[model samples]
Target: MKELHKTSFWESLMIQKRVIGALLMREIITRYGRNNIGFLWLFVEPLLMTLLMVLMWKFFRADQVSDLNIVAFAVTGYPMMMMWRNASGRAIGSISANISLLYHRNVRVLDTIFARMLLEIAGATIAQIVLMGVLIAIRWIEMPADVFYMLLAWLLMAVFAVGLGLVICAVSVKFEFFGKLWGTLSFVMMPISGTFFFVHSLPQQVQEYALKIPMVHGTEMFRAGYFGSSAVTYENPWYLILCNLVLLLFGLAMVSKFSKGVEPQ
Candidate 1:
């Protein structure tokens, strides 16, 4: 019985792996197409946006935010923001977009959401690495003080993104208006996301309030890794982890509940 159970577990794992892989391929093909740039667009799109932001900040706000390298700040902050937005945004309508795929016996709703989340995370991570490498080589930015901590914070942010994405996916499917609502809400979230500014730069009261947000903590943690003691980060990693865990559990429950009622189209 133990051997059989082990075999069954591995088989299920392999099946899920294959399903996610196939969905990723399909997602890339559908979104990017097989034309000139193709998959390269994944990295290029975010790179260009980061470059634009870097230029804007360097030229327009160089002295506005003192003691910070605008180019490095833009590269780190913007890509993280894009990761959160892109992952959750794509997940919002993932079910509806891939409704036909759900008709297949092996294709689950979570698979669709995971595929999009993974794709966005992968793309953003690649863009971040490449952009940071170039910036370091050009002497625009120094190497991070602690690469592991930086990656840890980024991973935490990605987890938070996935949890939020799953919840948004479940809710958007159940309520038609949620999709539109989230679009507006995401914009509202930007200023508070610790993307353009550091938490310590704000007033004490404002910093207290901003720490309530999980994304703020994640961003602070990442910045801490890069800026070392020079960066002021008001972060509670444990708090962020707890919140993400709760969100993930709720998201899974919601998805499982709604998925049962999803009819084939």
Candidate 2:
């Protein structure tokens, strides 16, 4: 009877949700106090980033990519990748960075990690919506071809970001240089992830490699919903979703293991 009672899934969900919510609120306050712009920058930062990337691409790659819309390409691709990048990068050293808070017994390590993830997700989501809205208003990017699929892709990408964030956070707690390593890697990943150009426009061999990067698939899927038949072939939303799930489970397991002795030791 006790075992059966402990197996109540809904009860567990409620508990986790309550914990996550509390942490999220605290995170918001700590990260974004009473500034006038406050949470608005979350959206604005990404918008500016996408715009800059589009401008740079137009100046340099105007010839290689002439068919599809570059602004739409940047808006779709950069926001998705930026979400994961920002989440994971911020999460990487969060444990050690927030060690003062962790000293409080009520502050679980998972709570700290979760708080960071929520903060990043909130910022990323705001950015995405704001950019999409502006693009639609100006007729720069169209509404999604398949809104449902686009939403599904966003959900999976968020989950994937959390998973990767957890792993990076756990690792960074033990190794200082892992943080620097990620910075370099992120710089290298920008062009390869199809942030400015359409992957389907690549040669067949290059296309295969681009598809291997899950962000490419996520971006292409998102743009497909926006551009309909004009969008590139994402072709493997299921694959990206599966990869996210696997990464999430693996990350959680690793965090649990490494998190045991992370408190001020």
Candidate 3:
């Protein structure tokens, strides 16, 4: 029993590490290929999107929310939300899209899911740091007052995203329509998830409803760290952590069941 346990432990640690490293390298190269700016699009794309959103919002809602700079406000929540959205959306189709690779017994479904999720998370994190650096350089945003909270928030958000992605990956494997539903739901989540604005700014009833989604709670914690006291009200940090743990367990259970029961058509 001890020997089996030790073998399992080593395999889980060493094999998963090897799998993640190889997959991550593949993702980075495939995303950029042999180019001068290889892998830079990971940051460039989000920064440009943030810039566009800021310009559009400024043109329309400039006077309505002048006190909170829209760019700074966006910098707080948008990238985090996009990280979840992009990771979950792609994860949902990961199995189907890579069915060929999974047919090889060595490439487990969980490994693929982890690889995809990590790729998206790493790309998004890099983009966020670069954008924040630019904002700081231009004096549009200040250094985080609580860098620890910012780090913690990002860690929680990654956990939250991976949990959500696991659920989506399992469902999409069994029901292809799940991919479409994921896309639709991501749009629905955008306005209500507090990705572009602070939660307290919303009406009380709206805030209560938004808090029902764990992602909103995750984003609130992230924004709190980035904007500090200026972020308005946030659910307790422990509450967010507890919710992420529950979601992760649920996602793992779902994926395990799916792997056991479902085979590709």
Task: Give each model a TM-score.
Answer: 0.97, 0.86, 0.87
Scored by lDDT, the top model is 1
Which residues of candidate 3, in runs, are more than 4 Å off? 1-8, 58-64, 103-105, 261-265
- The model with the greater TM-score, 2 or 3, is 3
RMSD of 1: 1.1
State the lDDT of candidate 2 residue by residue for 1-265, as single tens digits: 8877878876777777776777776666666665777756655776687678767765677537467766666677788888888888888766765667666656677777878877887777887787778778988666767888778778888888888888887777667788789878876887876666677678888888888888777777777777788754755888888888888888888888987877664
For 6-100, candidate 3 gives per-residue lDDT tens digits of 99999888877886787667767876786888777766777787667656765677637556666667777888888888888878766655556
In terms of lDDT, model 1 sits at 0.88
- Per-residue CA lDDT of model 1 for 157-215, tens digit only, reads 99999999999988888888998899889988988898988888898878888889888
Quickly count the clashes in candidate 2. Answer: 2
Supply the global lDDT for candidate 3: 0.77
Worst 10 residues of 1 by lDDT: 63-72
- Tell me how far the alpha carbon of residue 116 in candidate 3 is from the true structure, in angstroms, after superposition: 0.7
Give the higher-TM-score candidate: 1 or 3: 1
